[model samples]
Target: MTDKDLRRAVLDELDFDPSLDAGDIGVAVSEGVVTLTGHVGSYAEKVEAERAVRRVRGVRAIAQEIAVRYADAKKVADDQIAARALAIIDWSVHLPKDAIQVTVSGGWITLTGAVPWRYQSRSAEAVVRQLSGVLGVTNRIAIEPRVPPGAVKDKILEAFRRSALFEADAIKVTVSGDRVILEGAVTARAERDAAERAAWSVPGVRAVEDRIVAMARADKMRCTAARIRDRSSIPETNARGTDPSGGRKDTKCSDRGACPVA
Candidate 1:
């Protein structure tokens, strides 16, 4: 599509999401890449705004230049924000209360600690990201599973079977240490994201490398493109067997069929 049409579509998509305030955000397109400019009230709004633009078709890349303008009523002391962040993490059942450390400075929340699973690390960050007066979050929580990491494929497959949203047969799982590589195809973009999330939820997973391709692009491109999934769960599959950034694929599978990470 032309740059003009792409620009209109991106703007419309920004407006379509109820969670984002796209009015003050400016959209610019060049060769299918979108650049977001303007100031947002909070960091969450800025993130959601970019997420909204990503759903639009033909968006090759994004340049986020939006500044965070904290509302006066939303401003809080660093100590107050840290206290609330701790409370939030403590209340989340998906996260281990004592396993996470929170630090706040200049409206940014930095998470540090060791968790047993990738999901827990992410869960901790997600909780802090929603707290009022937060401008940004830095998630540095490490995944250090205590249990030996074997049978990851079976565990992931079982997870897919138990979940109604995932198709177990359409995807493949490979484990290296606490890391995982997911390869296969899903019927939809949301399904691909769900598959990755499921992979992360399993214990012993320190990282998840999504390589699952969405069925939507199967017709436009070859079905066998070697693709790696992004952390955001955005669809970027192709036959090249490389990530969207054209980086080399991960190949650390062990003979035991999985890495022995403890």
Candidate 2:
């Protein structure tokens, strides 16, 4: 079958609402793989969108570029799930609470910030995957360890002693409970990435927020940095497009915990 026919077949198989805001769906075909792009409102719909495209007979692989937009309640639920997942990872000793940034749009979650491991990279994704409302995730977190605090400077010194990616002495680390904070500077992006990975490997860290400057400003970085509390998952079962929760709530806890009492 022709590629156009194949694309059509893919769209026909998956369950999608024609009335929904699917105008963001962008379709491109190369070889047998189909790349799907667009802003969806929830993770469930995003998955369903991919499933719809995947069912097409000639498609061999799918590249999902679809973003989840938190325009209402369901999207808000997915965002909370994303936040809780990151918080769980932050429970680690080496992971810093401020080091990671989590955002959920619709059901698609984007993770930015830094960590210190290849395992942590996968670990972060695994945590998010278990979340109830997640549809897909984009992980753009970097790994690189900084110098440890004076009291534990030896630990930082030991962490990157043999690494070519870090200057070792140029960065500093501070830890409180499981929250880790990295300070100081690095001359290159690779060093920054390596240092983040090392910090993530340390035990008891809950999160990390890197303030290190890159050697050069990098583009091609996806714009997934969103204010998690500012958006809500507006349910799809509507005609007037009015948010029942009166827009996004200003609380950190979502469906995973008690909704904050006003």
Candidate 3:
């Protein structure tokens, strides 16, 4: 696609996403690389903008330059933001409250602590980024695996076998220390992401490096995109799109957890 066409397509995709207010953001394209500029209400919105663009074809990579400038004139104290951040994390069942520590300075919240799964770490960030005074969030939380390496591999493989979403034998799972590596090819993007999530669900997984590739089939890509678009539509009253008990990521509906796809 021409640079002009690619730029327009990206801008339109950003406009179509319901989880963010794209008004202040600017889109620029050079070749296949997409760059985002301007200001967003929060760091969460900035992330949403990039994700929206990635769905479009011909996007080689993303350079996110958007700034998080809280538009509220009423200046909020760092102490207040810290207290609110703690409250938000405490209330979420998906996060272990004692496992997360929060600190705020200049409206930038920094999270430090250890969690078992990457999704929980992402969930903590997801919850705090929507708060009013947050200019940005720095996730310093680390994953400390709790399960034995042998058990972790078994757990992930069992999860894959139980689910009919994709073929289990086609994928390979490797564990070293607390890190899990998925190396194989899948037929769809959702299936690839599902494998990552399955690996994270195991108790002792500190990191999940998704080296998984998908077959370069046009029909598969189209179906995968359609699935993401359909699932991302305005979630129900429960802000987190899926149940915490569900195998999917335990995500909050307000931020990256839930988004409306067009």
Cα-based TM-score, every candidate: 0.70, 0.33, 0.69
Relative to the true structure, candidate 3 reaches a TM of 0.69
Clashing pairs in 3: 146-204, 147-204, 239-253
Q: List lDDT for all candidates, in order.
A: 0.75, 0.58, 0.75
Candidate 1 lDDT over residue span 1-262, tens digit each = 6789989988888888888888899999997678999988888888888778766766656899998888788799999999999998999998876988999999899999998778778778777888889989999998777656787767888899888875676677888888889876554556767788888877778788877655444432333232223223555546865446554333332222211110
Q: What global local distance difference test value does model 3 have?
A: 0.75
For candidate 2, report its TM-score.
Answer: 0.33
Task: Put down candidate 2 lDDT per residue, 140-183, tens digits, no spaces.
Answer: 87755443433333454578676777676556666664456665
Candidate topping TM-score: 1
lDDT of 2: 0.58
* Candidate structures ordered by TM-score, highest first: 1, 3, 2
lDDT of 1: 0.75
Q: Write the per-residue lDDT of candidate 3 for residues 1-262, one digit (tens) a residue.
A: 6789989888888889998899999988986678899998877788788778867766656798999887568457999999999999999999986999999999899999998777899899999988887788999998876777778888899999997867786577888878888865555545666788888878768778876655435533443444444476543233666543343432221222111210
Query: Which portions of model 3 show Cα errors greater than 4 Å?
Result: 1-6, 30-32, 57-60, 72-74, 160-171, 184-192, 213-262
